[model samples]
Target: MIGIDLGKIFKGNLKEAVNVVNRVKEEHRSYLYSGIGRASILLFKDDFEKSVAFIEKIPPSYRDFCYQGIFYETVMHFHKYSPINNGWDSEWDIAKVIELLEKVDEKYKSSSCFGIGRGIMSFEFYYAESRRYLFSDLVWKSGKALEGIEASLNGYCFQGIGVEYGRKLLNYFFAQDYFQPEQGYSLDNRFFSEPLNKEINRTLKGDKTLKGDDRENYYEGIKMAVLENFKDEKVRNYILNRIRERERSSGN
Candidate 1:
């Protein structure tokens, strides 16, 4: 709905669209503002900086939401290239987005970063064609590894990954190719454990004080993401072992 309106109102006239959104009541502008952010990208598809400048023109109250949309679209753009053959091509997008994210106010940075994580992993599953391709090879290969993102935003990013991962696991009908029992492709332990383990490891190492309930909450989200879909003992146990190793190291 917001997208439809944006497409009609934003037909090469950013100021006209901005003026219209500015007049909309504050109570109903969040999604609309985010849509405007997405529109900025689409309108300035040839120039990333122009998109950023357009987002800056939005009111401060809603600018972060626009930034969140930008984060998502930027991530999608970054993943378009094949990780194996086009590794160098995508790094610039990540680096530039991180620089853009750093400019977001602290209050909004968490949400924006979370959007990036969710946006990236959403495609990870979207690109999966079968059980052998159950998870994103790009993610597993560290092609879109978010090493450059701020450390404090790690929890939100993990939560974003958890949300998409959990949702994907539940799509038994829609994603039968990846979830069906008879696919004969063993669900590799790395597919489930490696990314979660890697992020948790980085989080703890970067901030050891991120322990107890605060840390466990993120781990629990990761656990719940898979617990329902993975009933096999080996798969469940493997995830537990990986998490437990980090849990013990963190003195949890």
Candidate 2:
């Protein structure tokens, strides 16, 4: 079996390795398209060098997934895009897969990388949103992907992301197709609301100009303004729950 140690071997020549992986993807398209072959089996069966080669081709935006230390997850990322387009848990290999997942959790739990999410879901920046698509094509394409691991990503990966990109994501609400007459799309309000609220809170907290309740009142007013898009107070309250959900999602 290829095992996980191959990450070190392939690191020396990533570009050449990527070319080789492209060969596997192109040469073995049929293997990927078949029902039984869709599992990680096809990738696992490949030569170690070839598997690593395929992995090297993953986008630079997903650089956080490189084989530096988080090797298995790096492998899983490419596996998603490889001929084997799905995960496998056959009795023979299920234990190995479980071991890999535990490793993934451990690695992410202690690490801190602000760009990790934009790296993992950067594609979402341009094309997909996890809430809309259960898993964006880009997410599955990464193979080793997961959503909001350990809640640590809130500050490091997501909450700290660029406001411009965040604004683009928020722009979806203004779209004719997304904004409904019945406030049906209120669920999406937090995509922008949370960030805006966070910014408001940050500014208010830091402002020497506004003291005590003055700052608190200013922050509250900004939150109410965000609710302006929702004519119905009930819907606005529901859509604006993200601020509260942060702690819940974080399990704090």
TM of each candidate vs. truth: 0.52, 0.25
Model 1 pairs whose backbones collide: none
What's every prediction's RMSD, in angstroms? 9.7, 16.1
| Candidate 1, residue 108: lDDT | 76
Question: Worst lDDT window (10 residues) for model 2?
Answer: 30-39
lDDT, each prediction? 0.58, 0.34
lDDT of 2 at 72: 29
Q: What is the lDDT, from 0 to 100, of the residue 222 in candidate 2?
A: 30
Superpose all Cα atoms of candidate 1 onto the true structure and report the RMSD in Å to 1 decimal: 9.7
Over 4 Å off, model 2: 1-112, 125-132, 135-155, 158-168, 176-241
- Quote the lDDT for 146 in model 2: 31
Q: What lDDT tens digits, residue by residue, belong to model 1 across residues 1-252? A: 584368347666656777777688875576677667667666777577777777676677777777767777767764433533333213323666676777666877876776676676666556553323524232332224566887667667655555555545445332433334454324454443444344434323322334454455445545655565556777567656766787777676
Q: Worst lDDT window (10 residues) for model 1?
A: 84-93
lDDT of 2: 0.34
Candidate 2: count of backbone clashes, pairs at least 3 residues apart or interchain: 6
